[model samples]
Target: MNLFDLGWDDFASKSFHPFCSGDLVPARVALGHKHACELLSAHGELLAECTGRLLHETASHADLPAVGDWVAVRLRPDEPRAGPASRRRADIHAVLPRKTKFSRRAAGDDGGEQLLAANVDTVFLVTALDANYNLRRIERYLAVAWESGAQPVVVLNKSDLHPDPAAIRAAVESVAIGAPVVALSAAHDESVAALAPWLRPASTIALLGSSGVGKSTLVNRLLGEPRQPTGAVSDAVGKGRHTTTRRELLVTPSGALVIDTPGLRELQFWDVANDSLDSTFADIAALAARCRFGDCAHRSEPGCAVQAALEDGSLDADRWQSYQKLQREQAYAARKADPRLAREHGTAWRKIHRAQRMQQRLKSGE
Candidate 1:
């Protein structure tokens, strides 16, 4: 396979320049296993393992080769391997810097991030029009998508199952905000073509959503084959059965790259971007900016535009709640990840509350 077809470009070339002079070659991770990963490079497909130095220097599992990651590997071509198929092997020496990464807090309370996909150009936040669809869940996914530094496209799959997909699409549009909303049944080839605009040559797109959201079906549609397994939705559970067991990247005949990952059970905030709130909830941010108090909590602050919007019909009550929930989650995650910052936040909140109490006492002529 061509390196360009694996999403390699000038930026990647520059990143691997130091390793270029050595026996090392650049490769893109196709499928990652426990201790090894399938890589695509100028030498074609090969299975590779991280070298001792690479492993010893790695601080976190997220630093390891993940699907859609580019790495510098040293190939042992012409060397005999003790394998049934005599497949070639390589040693991954280094990983290239990721331009964008989709991450979430680990499943447990480790206070660490788990990388879902890396170096992606676009992220398709897939959601079903079935019972699995939830506006708040879409809002949650949008938080991480905005922080990933990639363009988010809300793909409302399984439109055929909905009573009125157009109405549902409008509802999703309200929460998706800056992201483009595209509703289509991935079961059809022509219907999935609506995503063609983002499937440019040498660009990587990741499919992410809860189970049964048709991410594998979307990949198969784009691949023009049934490479990724698909499972029917269990009527009893109202969720799609587990079909994709692992994450894998495949290049289309048109040179576009697509990655399909298993359904995420828990989507938590990782690194809250400085502008994600402003970008995802522009309406609320704008209203807050117009508040009379610079630190308006939007709760009981006088001249608070947010509360005023909620008083009128301008703002959706549920959306404001979702924004607050996400903000709290991000703030908590930040504090948990850093103890010093946690103490500082505690102090800050105390000061704010004290100030509010003092103002109330003065108003009461205490």
Candidate 2:
């Protein structure tokens, strides 16, 4: 397959222009190994590792080439990254510009960013109908997916297990604003058809969710075979067994490119603008806009539209709480990423509270 078949285009050509040379060739990272990566090039698949320049020059792990990333590589017959060269060993020099990338805070106390998927066109947030399903989790996925510059699709898998799948879909739809919601049982062959619209030829879609959400089963269903291992959900916990251990890119028979990832137990945001949060909870944002006080906290503030909606039957109280929780979480991440932001965060909230008090006094004619 040529570069075009691998989703290469003019933008990629331009992004890789500076690195174009006789020795370098364009390749896509099909799989990322701990010390090496499997790359797909015109000459075929080759095992590659980062050059000394890339290893020392990159600022963080996010800078390295990852699965689904197009990169400039040198297929040297003699110069492998480590020891003697293999059949078609390669050295990844640099990664091309990523049109879209899904990222999250690195695991543990380390304040770092982890790139989940790069150069993806769409992100399928899969969740099972059993004990793994949660509206809050879906909202969190939507927030990161929105910030990733990719179209978000909520896949409600294991529909066969739920008696009221339609009702659950309706409930999920209420929170997954501006994103398509698909309900299907990945075990059934016919269910693959529901995911066909996003599986267009050459387009890239990444499947992401927590363990036991049927991600591997969904991948196998799309492949028309059991290439990926599948496991049954534990009856005691109603959760799925984790089968896929790593992230890899696969091409379906229909020609669509897919990146399947291991289940994420915790998903925290990296440094991101509030636009993503606003997009995820647009209903709350729209209500907050109509509040009498611009600085109104959704608590007992007068004419607080968000509070009003919570009091009436207009908005679900859980969703409102979810929005606030995400807001706080993202804020904390921002502070950790930038110490200046951390210093200003307290002052910023104090200013808002002072303004709120003034607004309240004016509204009360004091």
Candidate 3:
């Protein structure tokens, strides 16, 4: 098996220059389970583990090898080194720069974001066309996808189960803002060809959605076999139970590489670019440009173009509110790292609010 067909050129061109010059083996991590990894190297597929030195020196989660990280490994097949009897461990000397990384803030009180998948060229935001269909959730996923550097292609899976998949697609497309949306049934294998453009050889795509959305079934379809197990959806809730428990990269028969991750119940905000909010809420952002004041909050502010549009039926009120909520969340996430600065900004806002309240009280003589 030629590892070069698995997008090795990307790693070779970017990582090979500065680090190892002679007899260094470059490999891509196919799967990561705890401390063990399955690496596709120039030699062959090997059950690999990180070196003790690498593990001892690593302090952060990002330092570990992820599913898509390209690493330079020192191969020792038939020889044992002096330290602790070297047992074919791969020393991940360096990580290649990622083209695009999909990440999310980890659940709970920890403020740090976790990198889910790196170097993904495209993101398949899968959603079931059945009762699980939710345009609002799709919209949120779109924001997260835009925040990542990858292009998002919305996939409305389980179309065969729905009587009218067109309705769901239309509703999702209404807010897709020109993003490509495809309706297909992963079980029946129909219209799966529509995703071929993104499944080109060496291209890496990831499927992200809630449980029972047929992501695993879709993975089986793409692989042309039942590589990932499938589970039946609950009869009561019509939702499939969580089947895929880990993020593993699989190579399809078409030679395209794909990473299938476990279902995500909560999609949180992370390090979003400044333009991501504008791109996700283009309608609101564009109208804000025409506002009378340069900094219209769109809240009860006079001459608020966004509020005017919402009131006059030019823009959907619900959609506008959703846009505002996401914008506020993005703003909060941006300031989350600097707690001190956030507190200072909060104090300034509170002072402004108090001043406004005092002015209103004086005007009414209350």
Candidate 4:
């Protein structure tokens, strides 16, 4: 396979040059498992594991290989293999710097970043139009997409189930800001063509959303085969069963690369900056510029444009609230990631607690 078809460029070539003189070969990670990975190299598809040195030298799990990541691997061609059970394999030594990455806070209380997909050019934020339609969720996805340094296109799947797909697209457009919103039923082959603009050859796109949002179905449609499993939504909760358990990168017949991620049960903020948040909530940011106070909180602050818009029904109440909620969550995540911010937050809370205690003492005539 040509490296260009895998989204490789001169930049990647230069980055891999230092390793090329050695026994290492360039490859792109296709499927990432618990301890092993499937890579697509110039020699063809092969299974690979991280070298002990690589693992020991890595800072965290985020440094490990992820689907769509380009890496240097040492092929074990001389090793005798039996059949399909023992195919060609290699050891990943190094991961090239990613041009773009989609990530979220790792699940659990560890407060670590989790890399979802790397070197992606576009992110398809999929959402089912059934009972699972949610604008707030879309906003959250958009914020992360912007943070990933990739163009985000909102894909509203299951359009056939919705009475008015256009109306649904319009609703998504309101929160999507400048991002394109595509409404199509992935169940039909023709409808999937709507995504062709973003599915260009030699570029990579990732399917991300809550489980049962038809991400796998969309991949199957694009592949023109049932390569990915599809499951029915439960009649009780309208949620689809989790079929994709891991992230896998697949090549479409048109030569475009697509990564399908397991349905995200929880997507928390990690490393989301103010610029990305402003980009996602451009409407709110624009309004904030006109506020009388430079540091306007936009809550009950007087002459706050955001508050004025909300009162006059100019801004969607839900969108504004979603922005505020995301802002707080992002701030909290930042504080957790930075010790100074955490210390300042702790000190402020301590002051507030002390003030409350003083008020209580005064009431008690102490």
Number of the predicted model whose TM-score against the real structure is largest: 4
- Where does candidate 3 clash, by residue pair? none
Clashes of each: 0, 0, 0, 0
Error of 4 at 74 (Å): 1.2
Put down candidate 3 lDDT per residue, 39-82, tens digits, no spaces.
77666665577777778876656657777777777776555555
For candidate 2, give the lDDT of residue 81: 45
User: What is the C-alpha lDDT profile of model 4 across 65-116, one tens digit per residue?
Assistant: 9898999999986577676565478999999998888878887886687899
TM-scores vs. true structure, each candidate: 0.88, 0.87, 0.83, 0.91
Better of 1 and 3 by TM-score: 1
In model 4, the runs with Cα more than 4 Å from the true position are 84-86, 232-247, 347-366
Candidate 3 TM-score, C-alpha based: 0.83
In the predicted model 1, the residue pairs found to clash are none
- Evaluate residue 45 in candidate 2 and report its C-alpha lDDT on the 0 to 100 scale: 72
What lDDT tens digits, residue by residue, belong to model 1 across residues 175-265? 7888999999998778998999999998999999997789888998998988777765322223534322343888877778999877777
Number of the top lDDT candidate: 4
Candidate 2, residue 39: the lDDT equals 81
Candidate 4: 10-residue stretch with minimal lDDT: 234-243
